[model samples]
Target: MINRIKSGIPGLDEFIQGGFPLPSVLLVLGEPGTGKTTFGMQSIFYAAKRGEKAIYMTGIAEPVFMIKKFMSSYKFFDESFIENGRVQFWDLGTSIQTMGPKKALDAITDIVRETKVTRVIIDPLPLAQLFSSPVDYRRYLYDFLAALRNLNVFTIIVGEKADESAADLEAYMVDAVIILYLKSLDNPLVYKNLMRIRKMRGTNHTRDVLSVEITENGMSVLKLD
Candidate 1:
């Protein structure tokens, strides 16, 4: 039996066959304002609550302070975890800009090894693309992911949507791909949040788009026929 790492997102685990496979990297693709950060942070916090060490690393997303500020309203946002060091946040934006992708990867590997983190979140991972060509970025990702796998941690990489016609290298590399979108109905005024599990290796997961809601607590996947 494959070990699984529960997502901790309400009603989402059921769809992914109890959660993601252990030590697997998952790609969370969505546009801005689609709650991508929220999903990542919530998962880290949830793991921390279970006495597991977790880290949240931001690429080009908002700073750690702003992320905490925004998540403060959520029920799952616990300050105690941060205070006790069960959960930590780091910004890789400066490293990626100043030291470059290779150095950034080294920094991440060092932190994860030093902290012995079992879960990690890299928000807005696509920001690395700005610092390198497509080929370079892919090579960097391959190396970075290999390092993480050796550490044996579950990782979530949050990124923006890729063109449908093009192959998303990140998605292809990861073990699972979850896409989030905000869409309007016929009226164009009634908007809804939706989530889809496009790919999940080694698991029989649902492939349909499901309605979702971002509430005071966190995101919840709705049950739809």
Candidate 2:
């Protein structure tokens, strides 16, 4: 009996057997302009709207205010949802810079436990920058995910889809891998935004590429008609 956490992405849950499985970490890979942040934020905010405690943490070099301003333009960006503090945001770049990877990892797990957050989003997780060596990075990733599982939270780790193979460490480490692409569409296809689930450990998921849309309303997985 796997408890599923609803992502609130229309047409998406049906593809993944109701929703994302609980107590799992999902890696979302995407290139620039692929709406990775939008997808992560949309899911987190949607969960918050449904009375779930959610937090968005940026490991990248983005400022919180600027992110808020950009996300504010979205229709689902609710001040009410954010005001209750049930939905929160954090900048982990500062922590990584000051505390280094190990302490920063501890800080992350500490707050998540303290806040009792059920949903978490880590945007642009650059493992290379997080550690000095590949061995250290792999160890950190393993520990990071182990902590997440122990905490029993559903997490989404958003990252750049630079030239990488199926041998990518984080991709192999997570429970699922979802990739978003900014593709060109013509008569052969009707939409540009595309999505695919490369792997889902516990459920039967679609291998077929799906179409998506990102507007002021937020990201939505379009139904294949």
Candidate 3:
């Protein structure tokens, strides 16, 4: 039987047969305001609360202070986990910029193994692609995923939704692909946010476009049908 890792998002587990497959890499694609960061952070915080260690790594150079400030608004955000070392937040931007992809990968592997983290989030992974050519980027992803899988941790890679199709290297390389969309309604003045499980290997999952809401407490997925 394949093991599963709970995502910690309310109403999400039901769609994916209790949760994501264990030791799998998931690609989360979404537009700027579609709650990708919240999704990743919430999952980390949830696992941390349950006595599991997790890490949040951002490919961008944004300060951790700014991230905490924004996350503070969410009810699920817990500063204590960070303070107590149950959850770690690392910025990989400098490593990628200064040492390049090879060193950056080494840094990530070292950290995860040293910390014994069971869950990981690499937010805005598209930034890593900017540092390498398309061919090199694909190679980096292949190596990165293999390294993470070797650690037996559930990983989430967040990226902006590109104009490219699902066949895009990033989407195709991961074990699962989830797409979040913010679409304009008929009124034109309003928009509706939805999430879809584009592909999930080795597990049964709902493929329907489900409604998404970001409350003060965090995000919740509701089956539209």
Highest-lDDT candidate:
3
Question: Which stretch of 10 consecutive residues in model 3 shows the poorest summed lDDT?
Answer: 124-133
Backbone clashes in model 2, listed as residue pairs: none
TM-score (C-alpha) between model 2 and the true structure: 0.94
RMSD for all candidates, in order, please.
1.7, 1.9, 1.7
Instruction: List lDDT for all candidates, in order.
Output: 0.85, 0.85, 0.86
Residue-wise C-alpha lDDT for candidate 2, range 14-66, written one tens digit per residue: 89999999999998887777888888888988888888899999976588888
Clashing pairs in 3: none
Model 3, 1-225: lDDT tens digits are: 989999999999999999999899999988788988899999999999899999999877366778889988999998899999999988887777887777788789889999999999988674445645788777877988999999999999987774337458888889999888887767589999889888899989997889999999899999875
- Across 23-138, the per-residue lDDT of candidate 1 in tens digits comes to 89988887778888889988999999999999998876577788889899999999999999999988888788887778888899899999999999988774445644888778
Task: Estimate TM-scores for all models.
Answer: 0.93, 0.94, 0.94
Order candidates by lDDT, high to low.
3, 1, 2
What lDDT score goes with residue 51 in model 3? 97
Q: How many backbone clashes does candidate 3 have?
A: 0
